[model samples]
Target: MPLIPMKQTVTRIRTEGNEWDGTKTEIRTPMKCAINEGTKLVRSMSGSAGVQGTTSSEAVSSAQIYFDKLADIRLTDVLEYTNELGITRRYPPLTIEIKRLNGKPILTVVSV
Candidate 1:
């Protein structure tokens, strides 16, 4: 039997600059290492089953719950950063989806 692998979808947030004529253009820049690392970790472990008796559906459900909690934790961290730096910064919450494939669980985030 083949074990199904998990999938991850991530959004790229970039700053666009507008010229004098009001034309917008994308600026190519490297993403933060922390963000990239976090995304990779979330993708790799999202579909992991905790115990042997757990079913694929259960694994998917667990993954969804884990992602939700992670989102809340991220929000708290952002709030703390804003408070400490006295600067207003907005971070988008991750959108995640979990499903079963070939008797295994899969996790994915919807692209925005």
Candidate 2:
């Protein structure tokens, strides 16, 4: 069992393409998930080829969605989330992790 309930809805969009005819198809599936949305500080560096460097840190929006069961979600799939106001946001999976409990798969978390 997950500590937090998976009550939010997220759509997983999978794109498949045919190499022979240059055609593509998209399959969308809605899943019950719990999303933890927040911002993380990311540090970046910039410099010229031979010049000095400048380091900066910025806060970037990050979200992690959790599922109770094994989901048919891939790293290549795009995840779409919509709010109550009808604003849709899409993101690709940056990382995917599976959690096990008592030697059984318990939860899957995808970060975007």
Candidate 1 error regions (>4 Å): 1-91
Candidate 2, residues 37-111, lDDT tens digits: the string is 876888877776876665788889879999886777899999999966787889899999988878787888899
TM-scores of the models, in the given order?
0.18, 0.76
The C-alpha local distance difference test score for the whole of candidate 1 amounts to: 0.29
The TM-score obtained by model 1 is 0.18
33-66 in candidate 1: lDDT tens per residue? 1122212212222335554442333211111212
Model 1 clash pairs? none
lDDT, candidate 2, residue 44? Answer: 76
lDDT of 1 at 15: 41
